[model samples]
Target: MKKQMLLAAMSLAILSAYAGAAPTDKAADVPLKPAAQQTQAAVWASRVLSRYHYKATPLDDAMSEKIFDRYFKSLDAEKLFFVQADLDKYADAKQKLDDAIVGENLQLPFNIYNLYQQRFAERIAYARELLKSKPDFTLDESYQYDREKAEWPKDETEVKDLWRKRVKNDWLRLKLAGKDDKAIRDMLDKRYANYMSRSRKLNNEDVFQIFMNAYAMSIEPHTNYLGPRASEQFDIQMRLSLEGIGAVLQTREDYTVIREVVAGSPAGMSGKIKVGDRIMGVGQGSTGPFTDVLGWRIDDVVALIRGPKDSTVRLQMLPADAGPDGKPVTIALVRKKISMEEQSAKKTIMEVRDGTVKRRVGVISLPTFYMDFEARRKGEKDFKSATRDVARLLAELKKEKVDNVLIDLRNNGGGSLTEAVELTGLFIDRGPVVQQRSAEGKVEVENDTVPGLAWDGPVGVLINRGSASASEIFAAAMQDYGRGIIIGEPSFGKGTVQTLINLDRFGQGDKARLGELKMTIAQFFRINGGTTQLRGVTPDIKLPTIADAENFGESSYDNALPYTVIKPAVYIPAGEVKDIVPLLEKKHQARVAKDKDFQYLVDDINYVKKQRKENMISLNETARRKERDQQEARAKLREARLAAAPSPDDPILVPDPKEGLKQAVSPKPASAKAARQAAAVKGASRTDDGLQGDERSLAAELEAEKAAKNAKDVLLNEAVHILADEVGLLKTDTRLASRVLPYTSDR
Candidate 1:
């Protein structure tokens, strides 16, 4: 008999259950047996988790039940398939999952997955049949697009009805986009066929990965099982480089959408691709026939796009906001290597004049805490690292006689752990930056060994929800030590530490290479006895964000590790900025109230929030058209209002070598002379007009500068204003000087 151990790692427990979902029609029984390698992987993964995972959750009835529910949810999150009857059929496995793991019997999960695949195929067929007839656009019904909270259909008839409405909605959306009936029908057919094809391609490994992740994620959202393909992708991303289009891709429903276009990359420089645009097809080169990627896996799409540097990859993409009838546009991009220059720390100087104080605040925007570990091991003199690059930026800023420094960590998703520690060291002299508490109750303090500070000045840290891990660590430490004032939305609360364990290291014989496990091995704690866990580091000064609080942050994840506190590390606080912050906040509030752009930002955020709250959309074509028209009208009105708003006073002519702040006057509204010259050129009467060649180049340069100046970041402008206030406050308050001691052991 296999021994069953009750491994209770954390005393805390989540009280809530998974939301209730109604049942759909039962799926036809499909028997499944795990492949030999899959069984071996399961057994090995279980042992690894027990020995290495921070929260070694007991693989008992409780865990098994959670895994069962999670696995089903993973299969059909929108409650499209698998009714109560199917759940009843898999009831034995719900509790016996623990036994299966221990006895190395992986048949149960595979069996459930096989049944899910069968149901998926049936649903696709039903949807295809429904698409045979055009949807009635005159109906005044509403489709609950968000089905996560809704119950599954009770029977085949109900499921078919839901699918009918879904297909109708899909057709209506395309029809509204101006697609013809024949085109809409063809598109729908292709889409359904694609989904069916993808379902058919699902293998035993794919099923195992999905089930394994469900089990792992139940312990903590960050603890994940990376299958071989996913592991390789993770490694590529970690390298801070890849030879590709330089855009992150993710699957949404059936389309592969661009998540983010990396700066300095071909796609970003081209300025053709935008976030949320869906790629429908990809071409090998300019001449090659386009490969329709509809219903393809994200990995497969990535494989098609990523190729040799300087090679051309053509994408046929649909704009995110494009209607079903919207025509796809082809964009040809020359693939290039994503270099460290794209991800490295960059510097700027924003000269703020608050009543003639002339505050030259240095802005260092660190995109990631990156370090070329391999280069360092090879003993390269200039091995690229965040700390070294930042240190260099700081020195340049000092040479420019900057009054204060603002570290912009917005959207920095973190990288090297060692870099976060070393980067923190640059700001303060010899102190504990972050503490790591391991699974076996071992506390390791990562300290700043250097005794002298690289920067000792009034500092500000700009953060947002995208700032996570290493970014959070640096921000939290600065907040805890009172070394810098944090501005913006709360940071992404990811305090737990993850270690990627190679399964191949433990394997033997033919079943060796079994992907990897990115398990939570420890949790990080700030010097002030607080963890930047679920409640990420809240900024000292808050900024209004358009992003819904519910849809984002660490707390949004159901299984995120809870926040906890421990004994504070022995360290001196930087100073008391608590009292002065209110003053800064008051000033900030006053400035933004009078600022037209700030008002617009707030209005936009409110508009987005209102739209997000609305889940049910009308199916009536007239109603949707009218609503869309009204929205467009409102947007146009806002645009007109902004255009009428007064432009900033003529650019400050003080030449400050910082590229971002060069004085560039907006071009005068097109001169009559230039217009007349354009007409002359059209009539072949002004071949030697002044607006040609060198003059034309100068005109383009001026126009580009004007555009850049107009698009200056309003939030960063406010941050500079706040930093200017902080600098002013420090200068005026004499008693405050002793309290705000420059990096030293003295209190």
Candidate 2:
């Protein structure tokens, strides 16, 4: 699932702007009929899914209803455009979509989509009319922005009222950001105009993709249908060469939102673009005028961002944390290929002090389980693999005389099942890493055949909500074997395996391309018999995180596979870490109770939860301004407190593959008085500084760097300390030490 989503996202990143059927000037004239190949493709897809999909779901009345509801939800997720009358018009087709799919009939789906397009056009036209005059911001009213669960409007009048509040809220947001009325009106006019223009570009292929995906997801979230263009892009990504800004994008409403930044890619290196940031405009070269991208298709925006290597693309972005009153910031990056080396495992050392005893703990950060399959297939000995890289790092850490090793797998969306098994071998001598169960109930165990311990010292594995698939496999094995203590948040539960099926193979020589289907084939079970399907590997020591598991992981998806258990594989436990987990948890709790950074993290988590629960915002300008002021005041207070606290003396050591270890310079701690002085200087400069273009971009970069320096890795630091506590406990208790591998060093 992870691989497929990334491939789909990267395809959007690398493809040129889609030039579909010539756009008609009116939305009513847009193509609403299925293409010649769609009928055959739909039939083939249905047959393959029913015969071979892992879930064995039948296309009956129950499933047809799900498809019908899902299709409507996809088109109107926020329940903004459609009304009760629109749904009533097509109520009879709710239980017939399944038959439609099998019979290769797509008229109903297309007809519904055509009506949606008309409603969408009417809404945009209304919004454009609303923008002609300024809204009365003094009215004390609130807008419910998130209406995913809200009922459809009973009448057109009700929807119009909803739009009135929406438009008012939008205008007030800009006003609070210090934009004048003229600028706000002009920007909104262009935005709504773009919406109308893009709606006319929708073609038959787009409608088919949406309806088919609705059907696919009703069976399983992992299964999806890729159109011909998307399939071609997926094949390109499989070959491992890409040129773009290296960011994954998804359309949210009318905006193209950044979902993930590929590490070491142009966008990631810039340190300015981040997940959840909205790309409002795009520009070419160094001095091109920014083109407003609001209400544009996500793929079109991606095309504007992607370019040839060494070319420059500038983006006007709204920061993720910046609320409705936030101003847009521009960032420029040179396009380049995302390098494999950047995603490789990296080693760092953190010195943790427990009272007077200081211990050197080695940290291995694995972003993904990767291997050079082509090179290895060609019998190349120097091919890159996570296990090989980690083994070399282990040898170097041994030379450095580190006492414990912590494997950091946070945000590691898994890759390469073979690499995961081999990587787990680095910690344990040899064992059954994970078990795979086919749809026919056939179980197969993958083992580490060539194994001696790479580093047998005390070990820890750190994970979070973003850690998934192969990452979960490795971490679960480590926990099950008693080889290490698992720490941090529960991982993303995605144990189902997927295989791509080419639809053209079943086309029987028809000239049209039939696209492809990503089908779920099997589920992964841990050595201890439990599957990481809906319930991912739970950490022994839970940490505070801002991400809500209910909204972020596999359990959040509709119709996800359920968790189950099988007969446990015969295997030997490697250590007695489980017996000492209580003591470790006590120590961890005691340490973080007094840690100010930890408290700040808890506060942020609470704030996010509260905001998510409310879902409504005041449209009154005064209330909005007051809320923004309170937020800024709290942030400043936190900064002051952080400035007043004593800083850690230890510097992080990053190992250079060619030059051994290099000490990273830590940011100097700032005193409260110094922080105040710096703020004053910044305030004074804002009045006189007339910085423009590249100079302004440089200033933004510097500000981002300063913010990054202040953000501490509270979780990783705590993990290091917990490992140090374990090492300390083992040195004094001979009985406890006997049950675990004795720390050894060749130095």
Candidate 3:
């Protein structure tokens, strides 16, 4: 009997594994008719669920057919990337799915669905039987998934831990409301049954969502099909704050690792919890050995973390990266709600200089393109969003008389499409900002309908691999229109539009349950005809930041679409750089050769790449200690070269992070603070133009005397050399100096 039970368990496990999903493409062998395709898709969906031993949905084979009929028929061939062969294959697959759904000779559909249905019914019956007996279980009340106060279920002893927590918590709530345990349990059980039954009938979405996300990848990363449950989860991810321990977990090899802890959150406030921490165990409250959960799925782990806001839940975190001690780290944190506003966007100022020329550049650091979608859906147009804040900032900058601006869109994942269009229009005079194409072969241009341009001065856009979607769109359009200069590394490649559609709406009484898929509906293109989907925009003057090619780049993504260009639209270039390209190139080479920052950046990149390449790396103490030593060595080297500000007694040093004051000073931070970083246009128009021997010689003699007085030491000498070269551009045409400089003083 024992051996028989073991064998049966193994067989059931195997069946459940297949239930998760029959290979993603099960219709490959059989061609599907359009109607049949719906049935096949439904059947395939059922098979996927049954393999996982999950419950069945209300959706049936007939319902599946109707959903596919609307869905597949809606496909715009012109919008798809399918070639002749691909289209033919797609058709065949659809036909096969339809045939399967139509109750044809399909082998897996009926059996898998029926088997899972029975399995679900058995679980429910068991629960019903427990209720019938009314065993002396705890009168517990807790919200397992719905609320934030739920606790983690420790072991097999707590498989129905959620039930225990929910019942206990619900009972308390009812008792607080003057109800008895009998009445409370009855109500709570009713609610539980209702929720589970509805969820079990989620054939359209819940069980097969990962595959739906797979479909979103068919267009771009941003296009996603979110199951209802997944949709709720995605909302939390977007806000960057979860009502949990505040630790970000990711799949590394086979184990889930703590990516980073949100500072000031309950987990982060512990100080002991750090980035790269691995969570091997979790304790429900605080009394016993932590429960081992090394092989749990990411979603399961997430469910474990979230609890009622302000409720206490201890976490057992393993040390992340080794520190000075070169040993393992163990940390405990009490879960708490995270609500730190400090990390959000704010305005800052940067002063640039070129000799005596000074300029103040306004910088707005937007953390993310965020929107309160819920409020907006409630018809609140005045709800807080990025565009309003930015518009206000631009107005403020104008009041300060700031001409140049740098909008830092780095690390900005796109939010609302409305904002992208509105923000892009803020730059150029009224016109189309981007072109959108739909799966229905429909093309439309999203225009900036605003009355006037916000700013007409020089704009420099900085982006990196983290800048994606709306960021890419704005950058590409700005670049195409010759409205701004792009600076920094390439952006993240993601430029697709997604839409949410409910799958369960097709029919009533279906046995299958499924959710919405965020599928790609269209691809966006610059008005000038280039898609920012896979190949992000190229910057005019690339700066060396940590986000350069090595640390984060487009090469990291899977199934990234190819970069291609279409016919260009007639649009004016942002700036006339007739001779600027060669000039900028020359300047770049000079800076690259001498800039310590650039050199340091190169070394850092090489080191990172080396670490990434090495395999079979050890995580033992010896290797860890060596890494710490290497890091210390780097810190020491950096400290030695750090630019320091002069004391009150010494005025020679300039306080500037980007300005290498020690290496070269006089173009003080204050002087060139506002000067654009572009290569200065050269000319033979000298300030000291031709004058009689008396005037010219007098001016020269006076200039020499003043130069001597100003030239105190090394920094001054270097500054003098640079300024002289730039200011004396026309001096070589020595005579032109006479024509230009004579009126300088009088003017």
Candidate 4:
């Protein structure tokens, strides 16, 4: 089911908050409901404990009492089964156990554990009943394109209701999958057995997470407490490839939906799969009747999607935004292992101009601060990491005569502590990149080493809510140091460092235990004085996106630690962005008022919100067909826009720059028809809209193309005019920069 990682931002209002999100009550604070005052399982547990462990003992009463306390306290009292009546029943069980043990009945703890199984099953049966209830209106938030952190919802109830609906839908989905009552009970029993048999050491981590969440939320939202197992999992998630089709699936309304495809992954590469695509059915192996994966946990979906590498898996995706969503698209993909070498650090160079001056800007996108940890631990000096490769890429781009750069740290979740600090070093002349503070409050400034400033030119750093952790640190440092102009929406505030500890190290017999605890340790502060804690760095020029909402900020992150300030560091003032804010706001407003891309994003968000709010849909074929057509139309419209837009420099250029890089570059197509379309774009580029100064005829041709619904032709014509502004110049001579100046930001 869709796991709601949300919290009410306004709760307690403590800057440094961690679980329940904002600081407040503990497990004991929220008293159990009274209706479950006499739960049978609890009563049975008491009897079992007394009969087995305390039989014939003079201290049976006291022993049974203490054991019972541990038992109830150890249980997740919030599991809905532990109401006041359950507690009373547990107390009765304890008394019964005490009496039974006084008579030396020995088969107790196992029986009690069995009782746990029975009670768990029965409780689930009733919960299934509860789930048939209608779901609440939901406006869910998820990871932003920047990947720093999750965006928050506009309303608290919106997310809370999302969770409720998700749970309810999951119940209905299970029933619809043809699992009768017995099958459901058997499955639950097995799951329960697994939990009980888990290492006690592993289970203890739950308590630690609860405690750390309460403690960390106070510091900041991005600061996470990684109990060991979780940290390992986090590492795997950052690469945008997780052994599946790379779909961000979650349960929404009554369906498990495709949130968004990770860029460059299999799903993202498809161009056909998109955000809001829903998974209605999943066919495993060779296939038969489609098995519904809707309402399943993300983990379960992964299990269903994964297989031996190269094995084929069929997926039924309902494309959102592309159609009305009636019929599902069945896609079969062979699973493969994807590593950072394939997923991150994609770069391109774009040529733009302001009148007669042509400027070549390098755009580099770093997905995450990737590091080959396994390789590093083995002392592989050449192990790849973000800093290592990014540094090299910068050097190469400079060689290619790039005058300006756009470091696209969009969805880069931080990785490799050293890499973040080192990456920051590349932009600044020489100074502290970030600050780290310990629990005792000792702060140390982290300085950038091995840097004379990578490229001192006007730079723009693009970020969004997904730009978290190390990305935030880098952005904050650059902003503080006045190195570049920060663009895009506010970032996800995840400033805290998490340490993962393997429970297997401590629990020798717990190899089967997959869970680990992640705890927060260090907090990040900027060199100037502000912290990237809960409130991540505010960009110099804010760009609007669909990821906005008060709940999307740090305060909305559960159990986020509080924020506190320390002594300000003495530093030099950087350059100012004086009137940039107004410029940005104006530009964004103007764009939002007319830009179709901007409008489409808003529409997509609203559509998702609607689905999350709905209960169910009619499964009629006619309705499905109509929905499908609508979606296809939207998809075509979007594709038309993209196809008409700017095309990238030919990939063949790097290897053969000496082999005629001067002519107009055409778009790459996957097939012959696409190649023909590319040829048409190139043909249209010949008549200089501005290049050879054939402005009149070229403009008329463009206008005619537009009138004829040839947007691609028109866009290519426009690009020709734009590029003609600088025709004969090589990479640098006239097409790039004419002067060198320092890029400084006003912090």
lDDT, residue 102, candidate 4: 40
Ranking by TM-score: 2, 1, 4, 3
The lDDT of model 3 is 0.46
> Per-residue lDDT for 1-747 in model 4, tens only?
111111111111010011111111123112222111112222332332223211112335555565454444334333333334445545566755445434434234334433444444445444444443443213322211121222222343443433344343333233444555465444434433333332111222333333333222323333234444344345453322345565545444335566546566666676777656777777876665687765444344555665666777788888664454477889877666544343457555656553456466666767667666656667878766777777787887888886567677754556656677878878766677778776667788878767486766556677766567787888887787655567766776766665443334433254433233343456777877777767776876655443433435454555455666776666653444332334444544553556565455445545544433342432333443354456557666666767674433211112325443222222122122223332332332122111111212333544654443423222222222222222222223321222112342211
Give lDDT tens digits, candidate 3, residues 4-104: 00000000011001112211111212222222323334444344322321111223444343433323222211111112332233443433433453453
| lDDT string, candidate 1, 1-747, tens digits | 111111111111001011111111121343445666666667788888866788888778998998898999989988887766778888888898877877888888887888888788788888988877878889889887767767767777877777888888788767766778898788788778766765665656677788888888888777767676666555453445567877867555667777667777899999999977889999998799998987666666777787898999999999878975799999999989776354568777767676766777888887667666656777889767779989999998888898888898876766667888888888887889999898888888889998887888778998876677888899998888888899998877788887777787767786565778878888999988899997888999998763344655677778777899988899987766676788899999988888766676666566555555787778899997886666667566556755684444211223555454453221111122222322221222111121222223333544744564555455677787898888787778756655654543233
Backbone clash numbers for all candidates listed: 0, 0, 77, 70
Please state the error at residue 253 of candidate 2 in Å.
16
**RMSD over all Cα atoms, model 3:** 23.3
Clashes of 1: 0
lDDT value, residue 512 of candidate 2: 61
Query: Of the pair 2 and 3, which is ahead by lDDT?
Result: 2
Model 2 lDDT per residue over 566-645, tens place: 99998998877777889889988987888877676667667656765787889887888888787677678676876785
Worst 10 residues of 2 by lDDT: 4-13
Q: Each model's C-alpha lDDT?
A: 0.71, 0.75, 0.46, 0.48
lDDT of 2: 0.75
For every candidate in turn, the CA RMSD to the true structure comes to: 12.4, 8.8, 23.3, 17.2
TM-score of every candidate relative to the true structure: 0.75, 0.78, 0.49, 0.50
Where is model 1 more than 4 Å wrong at Cα? 1-35, 194-204, 242-340, 377-380, 641-714, 731-747
